[model samples]
Target: MDGLLLQGFFRSSAAWRVRIALNLKGIGYAQVARHLRRGEQRAPDFMAKNPQGLVPALEVPGQGVLTQSLAIIEWLEETQPGAPLLPADPWARARVRSLAQIIACDIHPIQNLRVLAYLKRELGQEGPTVDAFARHWITGGLAALEQRLATEAETGLFCHGDAPGLADLCLVPQLGNARRFGTELSPYPTILRIEAACLALPAFQQSAPDRQPDAE
Candidate 1:
């Protein structure tokens, strides 16, 4: 199979998730950078690929375009099953998905690039104010995550088990965003510990934003 074409920005958390997923699955792909800060995602060419004009759109060789980070990651899990991100058991899979969705669906969308841009441009908010708003939501969500992970029996070296999985993938990128915004993550010891464990893995380390070819 021809390698997939990934159109994404290096610093985008959604894009980062897909990158980590691809690396974990050992899937070879070509990354085409669409710098968000330069408004490249809104260009006519990118819009032709993703009408929504979102970064992290995957152009599968013959299967057409795939949008949304979670969708793309799920596709990778289905198509490339060597390194399974989800658990084998039904209940375990649900638990992992629940934790992942808390970050992906609940926290991420509210603080994504489009949301931040809207806050700044549409609402006339300043950078500091928008950043503070992002940190507020991130901290709140992380607090809840910490509560679950710290108290739950399932929490191990990673978010779910001793091995890194879907929850870890979602957690690491969100933590990266939180740290970028100067959010105080020290409050969540469990999260910090899990993040450290994930970073020890080559897949997560290699897929980090700074390690990307297009990283500034």
Candidate 2:
């Protein structure tokens, strides 16, 4: 097909983030459901598309496959002709990128599937220990983010402003991951408020994990 194709797994926060961006940008794309738990991402055919064997890889019609959720979203922002994912102001754009990186770079890697798999299989960590490990990192990251979103004057209805941007895409999915790991979220009022605002939109509502075709 000539349309965009998204390589993703249901319940993947990174994949979820991309889905939100696509929806927000009003892009039409097909989905290749790679079951991360079943090792579908590591399959040879899938690996050919993404050497890293990760979900949220985007296959452009003319261009080659794009890996990394943020990179894919940025590409969409640049090429697509829909919603604006970044602001006009350079400083605001930098702030949004910074907020997004807190989840993409700092929080996500530690609790990634590969890392958790290593902790469980290689290190022989028990269920509770592995779970605790995820919760610890997620909680700490949210705590820091909550402080910034609360204290910063730039914060409005969303992470950067009234409109959802790159940071909101990251924050919403990370919050979903946080809830999955049973992280108590009441402490982060600002984050929760932003999430509520995001969820109120059709884009966020439609892109949710539970709404995905492969959700289980």
Candidate 3:
């Protein structure tokens, strides 16, 4: 295997997405723990790799550093032929991408650690207020997902089809974040069902936040 290094914080959902994809592809890589809460991602070394100072910066063997979980997963899909993370059909691929973006682009950003920290530190929000903010946005996203997944015939054992793929990568991590923030998941039965199926697989299990080396 060519040298691959993933610099990420354990609890980071973005990092978790990449971890699941790498595991699903059966790729072996070295991990560099970046403690986000301690501002380690902002340090000079990590910043050099990702000027955005974000976790989940992947250093590929010859392609230089790949930032962002979605892009890294797309690179893996294009380069590594093993266990593909995306659907083959064009329309199916678009559907999968749409579901993945719902979390990655819509939900995850507002509930991220930096955003929550800003709410508390910069805006002077109480703990309960920040928690409420997270739950509100996550719940809204889950509500939209629930309506689609429950009614859409395309949704299967996973988000798009029988096999776990890109959508699952995004879904599982956001579910983890929702649970962490005490968001009520009972309303999203389809989501819970899909989450259970994904969790039963070794890739998702091994890539979980609690299973990571730097997990607190």
Best by lDDT: 3
Task: Write one digit per residue (lDDT tens) for candidate 3, span 1-216.
Answer: 568999998999999999999999999988999998899999998899899999899998777899999999998999896788998999989988988888998899999999999999999999999999999889988898888889999999988879999999999999999988999899999999999999999999999988988888
Regions of model 2 farther than 4 Å from truth: none
Q: Where does candidate 3 stray beyond 4 Å?
A: none
- All candidates' TM-scores? 0.96, 0.97, 0.98
Model 2 — which ten-residue stretch has the worst lDDT?
A: 1-10
State which candidate has the highest TM-score.
3
lDDT (CA) for every model shown?
0.90, 0.91, 0.92
Model 1 pairs in collision = none
Off by over 4 Å in 1: none
Query: Between 2 and 3, whose lDDT is larger?
Result: 3
